[model samples]
Target: MFNMSGLDLMVIFKLAGIGLGTTLINQLLKKTDAGEWVFYTTTMGIIFGLLIVLQYVLQFFEAVQTMFTF
Candidate 1:
């Protein structure tokens, strides 16, 4: 439903990197004796995931606009 010619494997790699970074943060926090860090780590991960997903949302809106000639 959207033009994905500009999207490629690199995007997937970036997302994976985000996930890994979040995992590392979680692990590091878990080791530091700071329980609150766990919540922060999870929140950061969710934010990052949402940011990545937003790209697709923007693309979807663009596709719809193009289809409607608006």
Candidate 2:
């Protein structure tokens, strides 16, 4: 009873990639002495990822409203 279109899968993959990349970058920065930048990097990554998902979330709500409306 679940539907996942190609676009949805792509967004999921994109989020996964962002998480992986951010983790790697954070580790690299921590090893170097740029620990301060790690927090910003992680925060930006989360914000970016949420922005990517937000579009779909809004669309889902719109779809539900449309489906329930006469």
Candidate 3:
């Protein structure tokens, strides 16, 4: 089962915020002449998501090291 912890929830909230912000920006930019805003927001979201994943990945590696080390 995928149980969520406080830190997990926080990460989810942060990612959701990023997605919502990007969506809002994309919607607003759709009116003007700049059609590339959607792509910009999408790339930004991907970058932010990757950053968050990397932080958790580092934590996971540290935990594994601590567990295996006597």
Candidate 4:
């Protein structure tokens, strides 16, 4: 029993978008020789994406607990 609601789809899309944007920005920074910023950009993107997924993971655990009355 998996939940695949619109909100979940949106979250997945958001993560993908963040990954793509981060890659593009990193490439641009590398081209301009701003190598230091590329790392920070990627780290921030990953952190933000993790936070988003973490919220859903918490919600999923809550749902499971409620379903099984654990």
* Candidate 2 structure quality by residue, lDDT tens digits, 1-70: 1234736578879999999999999999999999999999999999989998888777778778888899
Which runs of model 1 end up more than 4 angstroms from their true locations? none
Q: Write candidate 4's Cα lDDT for 27-69 as tens digits.
A: 9999999998988999999999999888878878877888998
Give the TM-score of each candidate. 0.79, 0.83, 0.77, 0.80
Q: Which candidate has the top score in lDDT? A: 4
**Which model scores highest in TM-score?**
2
Cα distance off (Å), candidate 4, residue 53:
0.5
Candidate 3 segments whose C-alpha is farther than 4 A from its true place: 1-8
Worst 10 contiguous positions by lDDT, candidate 3: 1-10
Question: Model 4: what TM-score?
Answer: 0.80
Of the two candidates 1 and 2, the one with more favorable lDDT, higher being better, is: 2
Model 2 lowest lDDT segment of ten: 1-10
Decoy 2 TM-score against native? 0.83
**What are the lDDT scores of the predictions, listed in order?**
0.84, 0.86, 0.79, 0.87
Model 1 Cα lDDT, one tens digit per residue, 1-37: 5768757887788788988998888888888887688
- Better lDDT candidate (2, 4): 4
Candidate 3 residues 7-56, lDDT tens each? 65788888889889888888888877677778988898889988987887
Predictions ranked by lDDT, top down? 4, 2, 1, 3
Structural RMSD, model 4:
2.6
Error of 1 at 56 (Å): 2.3
What's the lDDT of the predicted structure labeled candidate 4? 0.87
